[model samples]
Target: EKMPLTPNGKLDRKALPAPEGALQTGTEYAAPCTVTEAKLVQLWQEVLGLERVGIHDNFFEIGGHSLRAMTLVSRVNKEMSVSLPLRNVFFYPTVEEMAQAISELERLEYAVIPQAEARDYYPVSS
Candidate 1:
């Protein structure tokens, strides 16, 4: 029950045992592919308090809940600068799916601009 230490009294990182992948969470580990996916992974890991989070990992399956989902949404909206609805979390639990959704949303980011209402009739070129 002791940690491997070097002569300098520091923890020996090399001596430590490697984690056995996803902590046996029954899901194959797949690292994030794109920038969007990578960012989602980082945020999921932070919210779930896990050392590793794969792109294909299910948010709820990997210790996620409604409350945590809200927090994750808030972070995504603020950091990613996109309006990611909370319902999307459940709709797209995996990072891969979420990333795709994000890209689609980003594509339509400026599509919701409101325009000034025009009068009932066209204005004359007076």
Candidate 2:
């Protein structure tokens, strides 16, 4: 595809069309359903500087870089109260995948917690 260029020979970013198969702006969008997805969508919007972000939108395709990804991971840890490895962001670039990874991390954390052991109780005479 040919990129639109300005009179000065610079790429006209504004005139460039959205990539094929990408969600177009101003179209009806489906909001996130679960809390995790909602949080991710909000974070993506803030981090990526876009007005609307769908669950299936690709993070990198929307101008996300390594620094932004790191920032996103940090925010996710702070907001979601979970420790997620940085690599997970690359592995799960989309909100849906990231949310699923967060859910799995939460499940693993819950599973790792040690249960309290039962203790015998003795009555004391006054």
Q: By TM-score, who's the top model here? A: 1
* Clash counts for the predictions, in order: 0, 0
Per-residue lDDT for 1-126 in model 2, tens only? 688999999999999776676556443466888999999999999998988898877788777999999999888887788888889989998888899999988522212458767769756799
Cα RMSDs, all models? 13.7, 14.3
Instruction: List, residue by residue over 3-95, the lDDT tens digit for candidate 1.
Output: 999999999999999767555668899988899999999999999999999998899998999999999998898788888999999999999
The lDDT per prediction is 0.89, 0.83
TM-score of 2: 0.63
Model 1 misplaced regions, further than 4 Å = 1-22, 107-126
Q: Lowest lDDT 10-mer window, candidate 1?
A: 105-114
